[model samples]
Target: MACQSSLALGLLLLVSCVSWSSATDYTVGDSSGWATSVDYTTWTSGKTFNTGDTLTFNYGSGAHTVDEVSSSDYSSCSASNALSSDSSGTTKTTLKTSGTHYFICGIASHCSNGMKLSVTVAAAASPSTPSSPTTPSTSPGTTTPSTSPPATTTPTATTPSGSMSIGSVRDLAVIGLGGLMGFVLGVF
Candidate 1:
């Protein structure tokens, strides 16, 4: 009985950790896909990208090339000295650093027509020790209200379109295995 309980707890922990660490996969341009005529600047707005996240560019195989370039190349729509280039219709780039990354379409006139994208990735949040709560100091028998209003912020949500990422598939596989293990252990 104790063995089964421990197994269950271990399975729970595994599932939770997998879910928490699963990185997001953003489909560039959403439904419009990686192409000209799409406003990439607006597409990237309001989205908080983090390291470990992936950006998938979907386009016609021969129609366009996904080129990873420096800021100067992106600004000038130059693919002559691209850091990386792919014309395989689909390109998947994993953000490994915490800084801005730029991409542009290598096809002539494509990038100038707004087929360039620059995304700023933030470092992934890590687990930290909780800070102790502080109580406001007040004078004896004196109640003072805060002079300033509380600050509020709006969170942006992004949904991946068209396909599921490899990470998502792996997460599901882990969860399924955990369930199977639990079932077999229960029978034993």
Candidate 2:
């Protein structure tokens, strides 16, 4: 009976342990934000926040704090601290959900001094599937016009009306208007 009880407990614990893997592995300010979490405002390759991924801040300094700021794209910080400046900030917080998350260092107005960062969680795709772009039919039910000089069809030219072609009338009218305007200006 004891052996069966032990086996059942082991199975239960194993099942619980294998429930699910963490979707996010955010780090504190890396020496630089290259492919990882950066301080201030940026992310690298490994720091990519994806859909359904919750980011947890890690501090490296004792004087650092994650300040949630107001943002239009993503949600603000979840919490802040006056002593989270450890290069590996410990007073960390998790991003509520996958979206734009803007945070800054909140220490004696450190943010106003330009200590901030932003993260955008883009939608994730399945590894076994490919995503395709949606395209709308823009053609007006017509085919592309051939570019061979429009087939070089011989176009018979048409003559203008009133015995005056456009070229002569355009020039004559311009000269006549100029003369009339000059005469009026002189009289004035």
Residue pairs in clash, model 1:
none
- TM-scores for all candidates: the values are 0.63, 0.40
lDDT (Cα, tens digit) per residue for candidate 1, span 69-117:
9999988999999989999989999999998999999888999999999
At residue 50, give the lDDT of candidate 1. Answer: 86
| Candidate 2 per-residue C-alpha lDDT over 43-90 given as tens digits, one digit per residue, 9 for 90 to 100 | 444455655554455544656666555573123333343222333545
Minimal lDDT window, size 10, model 2? 73-82
- Candidate 2, superposed: residue stretches over 4 Å from native: 1-18, 31-42, 51-62, 72-89, 112-114, 123-188
Listed per model in order, the count of residue pairs whose N, CA or C atoms clash below 3 Å is 0, 22
* Candidate 1 lowest-lDDT run of ten: 150-159
Q: In model 2, what is the error at residue 153, expressed in angstroms?
A: 49
Query: What does the lDDT read for residue 180 in candidate 1?
Result: 66
lDDT of each: 0.83, 0.50
